[model samples]
Target chain A: MIDRTGLMVILSSPSGAGKSTLARRLMEWDAGLRFSVSATTRAPRPGEVDGVDYHFTSRAGFEQMVADGQMLEHAEVFGNLYGSPRGPVEQAMLAGRDTLFDVDWQGGQQIRASALGRHVVSIFVLPPSLPELERRLRGRGQDSDAVIAGRMEKSRSEISHWAEYDYVLVNDDLDETEARMRAILTAERLRRDRQSGLGGFVRALMAEEA
Target chain B: MIDRTGLMVILSSPSGAGKSTLARRLMEWDAGLRFSVSATTRAPRPGEVDGVDYHFTSRAGFEQMVADGQMLEHAEVFGNLYGSPRGPVEQAMLAGRDTLFDVDWQGGQQIRASALGRHVVSIFVLPPSLPELERRLRGRGQDSDAVIAGRMEKSRSEISHWAEYDYVLVNDDLDETEARMRAILTAERLRRDRQSGLGGFVRALMAEEA
Candidate 1:
């Protein structure tokens, strides 16, 4: 019921962690929340929509957007370019609609250091244990042993940065993690500095008996 | 579920502003939460239970507790002394249980400045409007005009201190306010510094494949 500025919820976790699943659950729980869609240089394989799954653009277009400061953050991953568009984020905040980001620690840090960084609430999610994380990764039944090992090494590097986050959660159980994330969103929305309507609300309260 | 250090959730509001009701609801919402019961010099009237409604004590005993630093904070109201005992609060935090405080701004400031200040999260509740506040006070059908006027003045003083709190919520809707409070607690619990167990959790993860 509060009229407030939207928050940028940055969720970072290593591959095989449940950050993506948790993010999906949170968005489903609150349909009003928007997921940040990154612009990618990779060609769509099949069912990926242009603006929904990603903003597919030519390499030249992606480079130009980055040069023009349109991208909040951009990077070259395995020869493909990908980055979040800054326009939608800024517009969402102005409209009091929160946007969620599923990014690694590098992207999380970049957005938090941006001009709109004050709006960011970064959370790091960890698996219950390394064995559990590997079990889940193997459960996918697609990645070979070599791929799983490389992913596990990458997870160690990512997990080392957990201390950098404002809040950290161990995703032992998906439902519990989802509940905590919802609570965090609920609390962040009520922060006094985020509620733009508070000044008028207080003014009216004072004028009531005047 | 998270295992972490307990926090001091201080809720302060003006007379007729609905803080007490909110505090009651919050305690009921989480049975594990401990209420910081105040020690009073006044006699227990009606159904008031000692050690629950209050810690009944003689004026001398209460004064001695304050002098000995046993009282977290104390105040003299209408020739009677009332204060929160520090022992139980300290014990509660060490046991990893949250403690809730229903205090005025003075008590809030005191608790926040105490040695355990880092553990406190103060929230101030604001009335929707003075007219609505006055209407509620009148609807209670107990107080006289002179009493109501005095309360309104006291409320203004209370409202003036809203800026001192970590959070300021307008109590226009009860359920919304409660939900927000729960969210704050959840997020605070996940603060990396609060969860002392996280270090061991992460260590276990690292040792999984080693």
Candidate 2:
């Protein structure tokens, strides 16, 4: 295998499309794959782990990181600050290990616009149908009726940005969507431009028996 | 699976890089995938079937087709004329079945420059090393020393065009390379812009419970 430069995999989706579930499964499938543990000012829920689930931070701390150019992308949701750190993602890329981003379209666009944008492979996940999406959100039972309504509106807005993504997968089934993500990674890794060592490798090939 | 628009797969490689082997494996994997049948002025070797292996034609006949603007791409090799017909490729695309082109860099460039170019996914296959490539070619033992020398020179010339491809895969092993090609096809089909019905689907998604 060629020592390929790692990619930044940005998985964007509207709420209830199971983006988190798919991202988690991908991490499990490849242990070396790193997750962009987002920094958030929101308090951790019952089972959440700091630095694992998210890097819990004070609002000021998050703002400081953003000001210092440490955050790859940042945004506020329900008065809580959340952002992806640039350090770990950069480290992962240099180490030839991919970093997975579970972000919305706004965050996805920001990362794609960043200096390291060329390293990114952006995929948008669409729920099978709007009714099914609403059903999945309701099945989670974590949000109230008003919250669901808000989420539905946000989803519509998010879907508008689907055209911006490099790949768009309709999440009709969990395993299939996960499989598609795996395929994208497998293929993207082989792109000529992504393999930095190709120049040296090709030169070595030419030298033999020439 | 999404009903994806068919793509034009162009696989180019230096001699002995196993391009033909991988292309054959892909055809076997998906019987629906069409192998582009090129029209050639060369006479059929004993068992070569008309319209199957190649559309064997007289030089004048091939020239007429070229003059009529029937060929998507045409080239002269050694002393024979060979060209890919446009009609079947367009028809296959409309039927939602990908057509594979095992062409050299020149042919690949022509097809990419054609009107159907946007649907093309071009891949270049490289041998693991020059020594290995020579070993594979010699193992075939089907060419004279002078012919082999000419092929080696041609291979080097072909390798120069590797940068023109969308993806470059090192053909170190057969099965692994075939698997990579399959993955590329799977991912390329999911590119958002390739699925034309996506707009209607997303609009329908918004219509639900809004």
Which candidate has the highest TM-score of all?
Answer: 2
Q: What local lDDT does model 2 show for residue A193?
A: 91
C-alpha TM-scores of all predictions: 0.95, 0.96
CA lDDT of each prediction against the hidden true structure: 0.88, 0.91
Name the TM-score of chain A in model 1. Answer: 0.97
Candidate 1, residues A1-210: lDDT per residue as tens digits? 558888999999988888878988999999989999999999997999999999999999999999999998888899999899999998999899999999988898889899999999989999878888888899999999999999999999999898888899988788988999998888888777888787777766776762
Model 2 TM: 0.96
Candidate 2: segments with Cα more than 4 A from true spot: B1-3
Per-residue alpha-carbon lDDT of candidate 2 for residues A1-210, written as tens digits (9 for 90 to 100): 667778999999998898989998999999989999999999999999999989999998999999999999999998999999999898889989999999999899899999999999999999988889888999988999999988988998999999999999999989989998899998899888998888888888788884
Ten consecutive residues with minimal summed lDDT in candidate 1 chain B?
Answer: B201-210
Model 2, B1-210: lDDT tens digits are: 556678999999998899888999999999989999999999999989999999999999999998988898999998999999988998999888899999999999999999899999999999988878877888998988888888889999999898899999988789999999999998988888888778888887777764
**Interface Cα RMSD in Å, per prediction:** 1.6, 1.5
Spell out the clash pairs found in candidate 2. Answer: none
What shift in Å separates residue A41 of candidate 1 from its native position after superposition?
A: 2.2
Question: Candidate 1 at B175: error in angstroms?
Answer: 2.9
Q: B139 in model 2: Cα distance from truth in Å?
A: 1.5
